[model samples]
Target: MTSIAAVTLEVADVAAAERFYSAAFGLGSQVRLRASEAATTGFRGFSLSLTVANPATVDSFAASALAAGATSLKPVTKSFWGYGGTVQAPDGTIWKLATSEKKDTGAATREIGEIVLLLGVDDVKASKKFYVEQGLTVGKSFGGKYVEFATAGPSPVKLALYKRPALAKDVGVPVDGSGSHRLVLTGTDAPFTDPDGFTWESASSLTPAP
Candidate 1:
């Protein structure tokens, strides 16, 4: 079973990024990587998604993120698929807070039920194939539109892929840029890049050679 052990984001100010993410998403501040000022620019080609139990939870999470310094990209709305919204974190990383279906829980919920890292790929099919070759099991796939992989572990963050334009539209951003996506995925295997240039690093391969 392949599990995503860690996801690293390159940030101009690691300390500030840490604070924003922690306060906004309830994520800890220990998972950030400091990058040189010259390395921070443009879209990172991905978005982090948090899936809660219901619509009220989604709204609450979105509001919390905004209060924590996130810029609203898309206001919360109910669509055929579900209820959700998009926000850009202080470090320029896009985030989507959503729920797949409406529930009558009738109470405000604040806990995040799941997390996902959605990659914007130039070619969805090709990128999906590359990840499959890397030993990830496919969960749900929508041909060239979207694909989700199943991960087995404590972290609930799943890996997914969507076309660049479609992803940009979902996150309310433009689909062109050049800069480190500022993302790092760690697994229990060798490091590799997908067809779309997204890097997956090995959890056990972080040691520097002597």
Candidate 2:
């Protein structure tokens, strides 16, 4: 199955954004940074989720992000599902660090299990259909509420869809926004835009701007 090969975040300062990412998440090449000044306000309509091993790991990441200059939108807390938190990076990207495991089983490491790209779409069913036509198979679907795409290949990022308002609530932000999402995904083959206006480009073309 096709997976998102990489995600590119367009930021105003490539140098600062790169440094922040290195210190905050150390995402390496799984995320690429590019230079862009596209006008954006309110919520950006998406979030990058980091799924870790346990609650301790979540706390560790949350601390690391704050120490690296990210503003905390939600403190690490335990919910019925698990423990998690939300932070907004200096570049204006919302990142959710979470784990389904409520307790720690071992020492906390910077080991990230999966990086999920959560796109907040206007229409879940429509966006799901658009991605399906783009050759992505559905791994999980929750009616028109949400959807997840399978990733059996080398792609590192898991893709999912959620209602925009719900996602914004999860991030503790308003759903209203304008201009670019400042995000770009490297999909399986050709480049195209989804029904929600998220762009997917060829992997070879996803390198950081020079």
- The true-versus-predicted C-alpha distance at residue 121 of model 2, in Å, is 0.5
The TM-score measured for candidate 1 stands at: 0.89
Global Cα lDDT for candidate 2: 0.89
Candidate 1 lDDT score relative to the true structure: 0.79
Root-mean-square deviation of every model? 3.3, 1.8
Q: Which candidate is the best by lDDT?
A: 2
Off by over 4 Å in 2: 204-210
State the C-alpha lDDT per candidate.
0.79, 0.89
Question: How many steric overlaps does candidate 1 have?
Answer: 0
C-alpha RMSD between model 2 and the true structure: 1.8
